[model samples]
Target: MLRVFRHYIPGITFVVIALDVSIVSATASLAGALGSWPGGGALWPKAACLVAVVLLCLYLADLYRLERHGRRELSARLLSALLSAAVITAAIGYAVPAFRFGRLAFGQTFLLLTVALGAWRSVWVTLDPGQRLRKRVLVLGVGPDAAQIVALRATGAQPYDVLGFLDDAPEAPERVPNGCELLGKSRDLLSLVDELRPDLVLVALADMRRSFP
Candidate 1:
């Protein structure tokens, strides 16, 4: 981990930051090419400004930190960061026309940035070959109570990341699950909590009969 301004961050994090910079810059260029940026000097300076401001907003939102986050949770944070960037960038451009890239251009760039970043993150979360990118979760039970969670996760609408299910009587057919992989019996609860330090342990068992571990 590298210490960035007293904040310890993994070296790989910088690569993501660099990618974000490129995305923002490209968005600005695309906007300018659309003839929306009028009377502009070279657009690079203006693009750089956008990149810096947006990056700062992302930093403030702690987006650079690698953590377990579901799509909805991650999207909320991204939306907040972009909103802050929009405000700060608009103010900077307004106070100094020299940095202004025109209203239409800025709007178009901002919109593009939003769409691009959102799409980028969707792929980022999905392409987790290591299965460690998303938030880690353990479902305590796989009964009727846990059905909603399973369904939500299946549709990728759940805010909290649910890795799998835990049942005392683990079945062979995915362990009485709705597309949720059965991790293990609840008896080994202590050992099962080893991976990625699960962010949440949800006890959603419909029936806690004698089989409860």
Candidate 2:
């Protein structure tokens, strides 16, 4: 997780966005390489513009916040975003001749973006599951409250994962009813956060402390 302006954004969010940009650029580059196209490396700027527009459309469609939405909603919204991108891209190509990917090549780029991006996201969903949407959580203590928290983290119902617990003692209890690993000590919160990078750090101890990490 990365803290930006006091807000915690999932680390995977940046990774996926980077991948999306790369995917978009690659598709654009491939289309730019078509025999009928003129410039060789001059395609980068146009590709960058396309990438920006596509990302903007996806963001506006709420694709980045997938945890709160379902698969069906995902597909529908994506289709809407892509269609919007295509229309905007076509308009830009018309108004700016220099950035225009010839009609044939533009069609190819659009097709590739749709298929490649759709396939990549599907793979992300299968491989990474809720990493994009769910928060990677690190609980501060292994107490009754933590155990109840573990209970409440229902499968497929919540948007958080209890990455495990941190305790004041070095050793964990014999039976951690929370069913999560004892990662480290409470004093090691900062170090553990740097190591695990959980999106949220929850203090689950029954006791209250004046200073908590």
Candidate 3:
């Protein structure tokens, strides 16, 4: 896990960053073409600059943070970042007339890039591979100890897909948290393992003296 802006992200940050940059660059190129820029030769430098500015703004806005945000809030932040990047790009163009894409071209590029980035982020959020790839965990008890595990799962920073708990004392009252299912008894471990195929099994036995097979 890597921490960014006080939020922890999985190891797939490199891949995600690369993909985002690629998409942004591609969008900038298309924007240039739409604006009738001289050619790829003249457009790439501008695209590179745009990519840097946009990415920097995103970083500053905590867009790279792993914490969940409502879709509306996220979209609003993304738009704000893009707008800030556009302002910076305009300032740079004003300072260096040679790099200017002209008012018309610059406007077109900003508009297109905004739409492109918005679409890319929407897809990224909707298809979060990290959530899909979270390790499936199975707890081996349903008592106070197991309840702690359930609470940890609900509040911990690390992402996990819990399959549920195994109740060793089948006849005892349910102690697991609400919404948490008692998958089965310890005797059914092998069959449950075959059925759920959990990535990790956590032993949370309430009784330390009890023998575990």
lDDT of 3 at 76: 89
The superposed Cα distance between candidate 2 and the true structure at residue 35, in angstroms, equals 2.8
Writing each residue's lDDT as its tens digit, candidate 2 over 1-213 gives 465664446577798799999999988878766654623337777787799999999999978765645656777888899999989987887787656677777888888888897887776567766565777788887766766777777565756778777776434565356456676677878877876567898887756663354
Candidate no. 2 TM-score:
0.63
Itemize residue pairs with steric clashes in candidate 2: none
Q: Which candidate tops TM-score?
A: 2
Worst 10 residues of 1 by lDDT: 1-10
What tens digits encode model 1's per-residue C-alpha lDDT throughout 1-213? 354553334467789898999999889889878888533576777888889999998888877654655678778889999989988888887887767778888789889988998888778878863344444568887776666776565356444566667776545334455555566677756665763256788886657676566
Which of the two candidates, 2 or 3, achieves a greater TM-score against the reference?
2
What TM-score does structure 3 among the candidates reach? 0.55
C-alpha RMSD values across all candidates: 10.9, 7.1, 12.2
Off by over 4 Å in 3: 2-9, 38-41, 128-213
Candidate 2: Cα lDDT at 24: 92
**TM-score, model 1 to reference:** 0.59
The lDDT values for all models are 0.73, 0.75, 0.69
Give the candidate order by descending TM-score. Answer: 2, 1, 3
